[model samples]
Target: MTEPTSNKPFTEQTVLITGASRGIGAAIARRFASVGMNVVIHYLQSHEAANETAREAMRYGARVLTVTADLRSVDQIERMQDKLAQHGLIPDILVNNAGISHYGLLSELSENEWDEIIGINLKGTYLMTRQFMSAMIERKYGRIINVSSVWGISGASCEVAYSTAKGGINAFTKALAKELAPSGVTVNAVAPGVVDTAMMNGFDASEKAALENDIPAGRFAQPDEIASLVYFLALPESGYITGQIISPNGGWLT
Candidate 1:
């Protein structure tokens, strides 16, 4: 990564994103890159995809560092943090977007399934936030955006585990926002409605269409759409907004 020029806005500082190889994560990296903000793209098992994102960000004049680690383990996260530091990539903003979705009735869900969803969706967020948030507090200038789901706000049937994990994320966002406010570090969540991403591969075309029909917008959101909100929340002007779970559900749930 090239050194930061003598003159650059603090907001142009580095932003680290977990699970940023594709979908909303990729969109977010682009959003910051457009503004020349250095970005650290984190991915697990998507090294090739992450490198592609890195190159794309570099095209926009921002330094991009791509790293890999499973979010399920705190040790790996600590090591990942160290790798960023080695690259001179401490983040001024952190986007905790790494998570997996599990679908099944409560009666049919297995213990492993429960742990997988909870581990990545909730625990990973906590781990990443815990690992890097102290730096934010020390600087008194940072943005932490947690990418949650609409189901987190309104529970969904047949997706009990996923909903529970997201609900926990919402709670975390609210609680942490208050704790970090005094330090000038803002914490917020962007809960999105169904978007056209690979996560929806489980849904049949007909099921997707039916779900879209229920939305007031009559369509699903693009990954870029959700990324826009994440970018906006990280702005210097967004300091006053915290402890809030903002949902972008295409009016699906009022």
Candidate 2:
């Protein structure tokens, strides 16, 4: 972790959060906006949801922008960059929170399924980070926070593809952190376990209860809890905390 002096006030910084239409991404957006930071909410196709998130952030008196870009496409991402530049909303903090999860055994996974998961989860992160990091490097100060999964750290039973993608993210974070540390930019990942989001809609009442019972905390983590950790990591004072895969798993994993 390297400490870089910044003359800009924290309120002037802008954070771009991908997949910010809802869930943990939305919570993270609100958390930053609450402190009057400029927020750019990126969503794939959820226009209304993204607008709703923008509206909520605006309540905090922060300048909010909603962008629609398919992270899987470089052309779209470049266009997104152009749009952000046009709006004077280039990000000082980049949150690669856009990702998809896959379930079931690897044997049942189709080629397309694997590609979609990897393309969005892994490749998208690479493209987004690559596109935005140069600016951060030139500025000599930035935060790159990636959203990962506990399954990436400790592999899950059935989610092989999803787990692999997130594991790649974990590795990416470590390597990029070291690469950017010299430039005074920090890169880290937040791998949460069993967050209470729509991603768990596939589980039934019994399944949910069974999973919860296995954890010492006896419940799933809320998006706001994860958002708070992200907010802390993005703080200017948190410059010494880079290359960490901080997992808030309710004591489920040590």
Candidate 3:
């Protein structure tokens, strides 16, 4: 595999991370920012939270901008792209980290619930990727990282809808990687297990402890840990690693 000609330094690269208002997305934004890369924090409604993350990122001396868009809407996404273009912040890296989770028996899941879950978790990734991929292909150098879940690989009993969406994301990552390979754009997914984010709030303390005990690492992964992995994947040296679904599950699924 031939590497793309290095056009810009890492410090000059720009990364756009969706759902970056908080949690893992925020961490990933900060991770990229620390290296002096421009960061675009995209949020659906968490404007205040997004600004908070932007402020934190700016402390690292990186340029930070926050954009709001409903990922489910193509028009909104286009508007966001226009805004970014106006600011000269077209992203060199795209991180599809915006997703929602659902927990319940498949039989108990309502149609609306299913659609909402699938729309945000799966369709949102598709829309964002479709919108931005052309630019990456034109530039011949880009990193597209999708934040996935361990449940996507090993089906979770209660999280059927969530698992299915992430599974689709995993598949999307792999297929797109192959399609974009010739263009020097690497596509990959980071599937994490039991992260200590608000997403885990549904589990009480005891439940959290039980889940932690099941992992050989004896603890849930910190957001920063996942962020660090994503940061590594975005590096120019990681150009050759594509079409891979890397699970950082702390020995939960080997």
Candidate 4:
């Protein structure tokens, strides 16, 4: 295993995490903030939740800014970029953790539902990456970490749409990593299994217990655990570790 690089100081870096109002995204933001890096917490409509996350991050003595934008909109994202530029916060690290999970039978899924899932999970990632990658290429330094799911690697039965979207993310991560590696930008994905976040609220007590029993670890992962892996990936020493789909799934799929 390669050690993390420290050539770049934490205080000099900035991170932008989407869907960071709560759950895994919020944890990732806090992880970066804990190191005193500038943090940009992006949310679609969770203004108050985002603010709460911002407050927590700021307590770590890192500059925190909350911004909102519909990832599916080019104009909004551009405007968001403009706002970040105004604040002098061009992200050195981009965490594409903003996504939604859909759980339902494929046959019963509506067209609109499918579109929404793909649009937010896959398309949104593409757009955000396209928007910020140029600067990283120019500077020859950047980290792009996509928050994928274990289901993306091992398909889930009832979550066909969600699985498909995340599968696309895995492919996107690999291909983009190869393309950006030459430019000194590393692209990777963190696919966690059964994280204990609001996303799992749909399951009841019995369901949660059954799922845990299925995993060898016998428990769901914490958001901070996933965040730690993301943080490690963003390190300068991890430059050689690109084009990988790192699933921290507690022996669930492997």
lDDT of each: 0.89, 0.95, 0.95, 0.93
Q: Tens-digit lDDT track for model 3 on 42-88?
A: 99999999999999999999999999998989999999999999999
lDDT, model 4 = 0.93
Candidate 4, backbone clash total: 1
- Candidate 4: stretches off by over 4 Å: 1-8
Total colliding residue pairs, candidate 1: 0
Error of 2 at 119 (Å): 0.6
Candidate number that wins on lDDT, 2 or 4: 2
TM-score of 3: 0.99
Task: Report the lDDT tens digits of candidate 2 across residue range 74-131.
Answer: 9999999999999998789999999998779999999999999999999999999999
Q: Which one wins by lDDT: 3 or 4? A: 3
TM-score of each: 0.95, 0.98, 0.99, 0.97
Better of 2 and 4 by TM-score: 2
Model 3 lDDT, residue 242, Cα: 97
